[model samples]
Target: MPRNDAPDDQAPVASSPPTRLALIVRGGWEGHHPVAATELFLPVLRESGFEIRIEESPDVYADAGVMRDVDLVVQCMTMSEISREAVFGLRDAVAAGTGLAGWHGGIADSYRGSSDYLQLVGGQFATHPSRAPEDRPGDERDNFLPYRVEISEAGREHPITAGVGDFELTTEQYWVLHDDLIDVLATTTHPVQPYHPWHRPIVSPAVWTRHWGEGRIFVATPGHTPEVLEQAPVRTIIERGLLWAARTPSE
Candidate 1:
């Protein structure tokens, strides 16, 4: 449920040009294609002038020195356990001004066991309706249905959502439990279906941003598969989100 409106203000302006450092820590469920998904954005980030580093282990989160100098963290882990030391290191880094950004379950559904990590992310995946009839007991067909993602009023005004508009996507529409503090940028409604619990349409945030201490957090939920991410608008949103989180100066 979305609880707040977009702030009535101009988008942030970076004070100066700086060589941003980004850490992409990826690994967990292969179903989400953690490696490929992360790689999809590598070129864009590189062309944007970011000094990129890739790591497969969550242990990187435990290193305070490494996290301290990083400007952005792109996480792709899903449903994995993180150590107390690592979790704290990540929390402290973000709180101290390092930005965090991710798509789908990479950031949202990760570490179901870590409440502190979820608190910083502002949301968690509840369920993604199954498309296979066998997976959906008593249902006749798959739940994968075409849906239109409507850009929120705030999204129209935000730099991260520049040139983005309502778009159609046929994929698993995620149901998420989210915090009220997040600024919703875009959303979609669940149509009444055989497997749905609600009789009426239910709205969910498709993209959002939130603040954690001195840091920023950005999330976009449509990238379940590479095809979805390949969509022009989706790619644009993610690129802009990464830049926004990193606080990079716009030319």
Candidate 2:
């Protein structure tokens, strides 16, 4: 018969798992407001049990020891240069399973001079067409235009974008030049306006992902400012993207 009393020797209590490490490498063009933009997501990162390490330079990417244990990298540096050593170190870290994710020019338009870096990111920001002279407002509004981000069939099934319907934004719509290696999740089309030179509507990838070796990468062409990043749908997508891109136990 089973005894009512508990056994003298008890099973060991399972301890909570350790928190993952997330490295936030941000700095470069102040226009992107990297600090504010990245800070908006700190709570999301912390709530997910991430031990955050913030850095203002890409040089941190060159630190092999640090990169080795990093589970994720959130980069926001735009229009800056990264050294060869740093590029290789970053590349190696991701290829070895460290996730990398960023938005707008922070990832797509960064390091214009580093082909290796471009190859790793799989895209480059060509330009965001501004209003014609007659319509120019002589301010940030000059480049701000309303556009729709349409979700692809794959995005509807992907964890990062699932349930997030197509949204509209009155912001800079990046024209990214990318190759076939990327998995496009969303796209934006620039319509031919009477003031613009383009003859027809042009569609560009607005959000995408790439698989590099054992790692994963995510990019969203929105988030031009902190306010934009704060939008419900954009914030939701970004938060999910960050977690989805993190290094998994098996990876």
Candidate 3:
């Protein structure tokens, strides 16, 4: 007890342990695999050292304060309605330095009628539920197919893709409004399917990350099913994304 000394040669003090991450994983529409996909991601998030707070009930969105004090937010809610105040609350929190992230329709295709939400999120789901003319969905909603994704220019050096090489998977390739501002992490090209009445070939964005003030954001359009994430490329992207989104990008 008499020896009182601080070692100057020792390493600097480490920060506090990571706290609970408010994982707002709400569920809706089988078209998006809400429950199944959320379950698949929870374990991975925990392995990344997060204490998940799931919101299987839609009521979670009713509480505007749900975003408070959370280290990060991993939203898995799909096709659900939230009060305008709730969106603003979460948006403000993120802009004020809280982390926000999600995948696929849960974030992009979500809140189809809310333009305010779209502005805050950067992109929105323009269209989907399409088929390849001769390729009928066979009375099924989920359309799984093999696809190749090309990582974007800015995304190559990000930690999320550090060791994650370009890869392929069989799942719903999300078609969305292409944006130039986003640091796209990966992409999937959807040639005008025979069933799609539109005559434009679509190059859909599958994974992306962005900066929001002191916060970070990530979006992926691949988890159309619980199994969609098991694909190597998909899993690595999310694994690194959670870590990256929870912290600031190096300057």
Candidate 4:
């Protein structure tokens, strides 16, 4: 973990202004509300010294020159498609060590029709434990309802949740299914509701991360609704996750 004189692996050292971040956002699977999601994070990112360059469409991938300066990519796209050239441009940028971080469908559920894309990011949202018939409306109790989150022993100490405590949310708890092993950050076990047919117990991951070549990757499942983003714990988890994913491992 030796320190580098430069900010990025290939870029020259800069002693003046902080690093600039290019946020690539597109409307994908309108369910996630791309505009709302991306906008929710702008002020926070700017406060952290990020220089934001926004693109309303994923078509920005068509231009490689624009991709070169981005140190980190905040993807808000949902299920959608971009040209093969665009995909390659993004993949190449991250592979070269530019950080790629995103949550929900923007990074994982995106390109559902393209297995190649899913394979690259790792993990997908297969189901929501509390959304079944009996669990309908989920923790519909209220917006601030408290719930318990179980931390993954494997990633308990990662930067994303290092000092963060176990938490709860009123949002629909997500149950993720993936063959790729992830460094799960936190989880919430669902106690079978009286109406839930299955007697077996269930566990759901709320936040997690996967490794991809030179880039650090992250995934969080609690963002099913817009209000979820406003929750203190949820917002904190996403902010750190993005920074954790984009940072290069030191020598």
Candidate 5:
């Protein structure tokens, strides 16, 4: 007894508009090459129809009006302290539907003094254990090692991980303290080493997403240097993750 057609009084639904604005806040420890790392994705973001705004300071987070209007915020700061005003502004903005996304130490390791920031990020960087050379006890420059990143079953089906297979890379395998609510997409296992406490294979999330109020949070932990970001899988994951976090429609 149901009619096949819609009633004449019903109005047509409108399609969601394309993502318009994005803010990239980059600064803090130069070791991560925050500026260069963020620049690598500029082209892709532009091509995807975003008007990007780049900032070298965290003060931008304090701009409540600007924060409220931006569709997405991509932070690239590392080990920096955020002002109380900036912290509160950012927290409130994201809670009100502005998406937040970042990679490496930018989101995870930043603002060690702020628990509110950490709660929004859903994780914290504990340590990046390096392979110390036995011959050179004092020289510890090259601490990075090659490791494999395995995609989770959920990731294999997710839009961000589409066409992405498990990949290997020579970089810092981050040991992160993460929230229980995070939906883990991929992970890496830490090998037993003299520098680390875990003797057995300890797995950690390499990519994940968490929800804070109405906003979405995305984090990818593999980018320690620019070379790491050049890897096909790493680049793909980051690009996709950025779009996903921004609430953009992904084809």
Candidate 6:
């Protein structure tokens, strides 16, 4: 995912930005509000100068011609199955330089049966710690607890998180299982509360990026609901991430 930087001695040229294509693949559990969630960013994608195409299925991945020309793939499918051909097409496209980006379970928790797909994204949603039954007595709201999302030192310099200070939110704070290949930008700590099984606090990556072959991958663990995605900071970060994960012609 290295940028093809031009030589320092190259002359600067003034030209309009090229129009790029963005493929939005969204569908899965209704609880995630996939349609409404992805629609939140349609205008932003257009404003960013991308010609967008919408797909409610991952089957589009099997269309090699379409995938080969896409500049970015914004997936929102969760807990769904993908065919072997589709998976290979997706992997090849990304490796050949098609950017992939998503938030929450859309990209992170998708295609559970596909090991290769899981490995490409570099992370998966584990569980969101919930309050003990005694704490709220039969209420499902136990999972929504206040937590702080802290920006790491490296985040201070990354374009996606620079100048964004630590923020607090009362939502489904995800506990993600990830690999060492990802460059972590921000994190959230799950404190050991009374009645909780874990003996010590657990720190999970809140935001991260991965470089796979010639492509860039971006994931943010927030955006459980449309309300969370509407938050000022959250919206800004996700918008920047979509742009950052797009493939450039030079690449």
- Which number leads on TM-score? 2
Taking every candidate in turn, the Cα RMSD to the unseen true structure, in Å, is: 11.1, 1.6, 4.2, 7.1, 5.1, 6.9
- Cα lDDT tens digits, model 5, 115-202, are 9888888889998777756633453235577788999999999899867999998777898998799999999988887766776977
Give me the displacement of residue 49 in model 5, in angstroms: 1.1
Instruction: State in Å the error of residue 61, model 5.
Output: 1.3
Give per-model TM-scores. 0.86, 0.95, 0.82, 0.79, 0.88, 0.91
- Top lDDT hit: 2
Cα error, candidate 2, residue 192 (Å): 1.6
> What lDDT score belongs to each candidate, Candidate 1 first?
0.85, 0.92, 0.70, 0.70, 0.86, 0.90
Better of 1 and 3 by TM-score: 1
Estimate the TM-score for candidate 2: 0.95
Clashes of each: 0, 0, 2, 2, 0, 0
Per-residue lDDT of candidate 1, residues 139-247 (tens digit) = 4235455778889999999999957889998877887888899999998887676765668877889999998888899999888878889998889999889878874
Write the candidate numbers in order of decreasing TM-score.
Answer: 2, 6, 5, 1, 3, 4
Which residue pairs in model 5 clash with each other? none
lDDT (10s digit) by residue, model 4, range 95-188: 6666777776677677677665666676776655444454344444322224587667865678788777877666555556665466778877
Tens digits of per-residue lDDT for model 2 on 69-181? 99999999998899999999999999999999999988888999999999999988999988777777899879988889999999999998999999999899888899999
Give model 1's TM-score versus the native structure.
Answer: 0.86
Q: Name the runs in model 6 displaced over 4 angstroms.
A: 1-15, 137-140
Which residue runs does candidate 5 get wrong by more than 4 Å? 1-19, 135-141, 248-251
Over 4 Å off, model 4: 1-15, 130-147, 190-199, 247-251
Per-residue lDDT of 63-113 in model 3, one digit per residue for the tens?
Answer: 656665566777777777776776777677677676777888778776677
